[model samples]
Target: MGQVERAALETITPYKVEVVQGNFVSKDQIDQLRAGMSRQQVREILGTPLLTDVFHAQRWDYVFTIERQPLAPQRRRMTVFFDDDRFTRLEGDAMPSEQEFVAGLSKPRRNPRQVPLQASEEQLLAAQRDPTEAPPSTRTAPDPAPTRYPPLEP
Candidate 1:
């Protein structure tokens, strides 16, 4: 009964696709941010904010979330504050370095197989024997030229 219940649960389980959304600001990008920089400069550095509320005209929110199976969902948020259209400060979760961030996003191969870089002796000999000749099934005969043609002017 336990085995049957386990099989039933596995059959009914739905596959969940990875969901990654919002701006992904790296440590390098965040480091480039300056206190006196303008909104445009901040945008260029971190990309457009994910959320900008009308009530908080001077604040811009950058939110990032990753939902992947077999692992817990990850979320990061950064809020940039401004005064009179000039950048002031930012607050958020500790961001990963560019390299660290890339490493985290990459998944290891289940079974890595090495491919032979050099051709086998048999393959080399076959290629050298008839390099220009293609297989009979792939070869198509050219159409014969017409013996006569209608007058172009008529």
Candidate 2:
């Protein structure tokens, strides 16, 4: 291909896909998991872990990672250690609380800019009226009464 054609193709080519990988766990649940808790209790609070190996049956790992374009990536891991079937301790990165997590996802609200030629009251009323109230159709109406009945001679 010529230089001009090559340049055009390169410019038009689509951007690469964002890579997002790993398990996600909330900080609230992690905080609830304390030392001396049974394996079952920890599981109930944190759900099944992402990694569980036969060699490390006593240790459960919860790993979460996310990556996207034009935004900083996030990664977190929570490890729960067990000694003789009871939780010993947890070690991982600090995480946001449930409220903070939710707040982060919300979009900022801004006052809408005023524009000329706003819709008149009449137009708004007309739009609000139900569209189902259209002109009557020529099609015949369905029978509201039922004709089927149980056998008289049982």
Candidate 3:
């Protein structure tokens, strides 16, 4: 592409919204899981599972995915295994702590400009006019005579 075309393309990139989907299971929530916990207890801790198959009723899958521009997409999955409707074990990718997950979602802005809450003395003085100067004269016009209207009942 020509230099002008490249420049135009660079200046007019499309905006892509950040998309977060599926269950987000934090490390803390996973830590709460126990080998003998019931399905209800597990649900209360980790929320609803993203995928569950009838053929594999003993397994519950939690998947999380985030797609954001300028950064590579991220996806994580965790599976909870159960026997006789009792929690047995879990297998999946290493999960991030709640703090780390939240922190990773956004980056702090660099060098934010500080705004002054109060005006400086120079600005205050500049806004005020000389005390000795007379204020501008105000002119008032005479009011027109009021009109009389007939009574509606008459």
TM-score for each predicted model, relative to the true structure: 0.61, 0.55, 0.65
lDDT score of residue 120 within candidate 3: 88
Per-residue lDDT over 61-113 for candidate 2, one digit per residue giving the tens place of the 0 to 100 score: 88877665435667788888999999999888887887876565453444445
Off by over 4 Å in 2: 1-21, 106-154
lDDT of 1 by residue, 1-154 (tens): 6998977775564878989999798889999988899999999999999999999999999999987765667899999999999999999899998798767776555346699889999888787766688864788898999999999996
Number of the top-ranking candidate, with TM-score as the measure: 3
| List of clashing residue pairs for candidate 1 | none
| Each model's lDDT | 0.87, 0.77, 0.88
User: Judged by TM-score relative to the true structure, which candidate is superior, 2 or 3?
Assistant: 3
Query: 86-132 in candidate 3: lDDT tens per residue?
Result: 99999999999989887777744544669988988887876695666
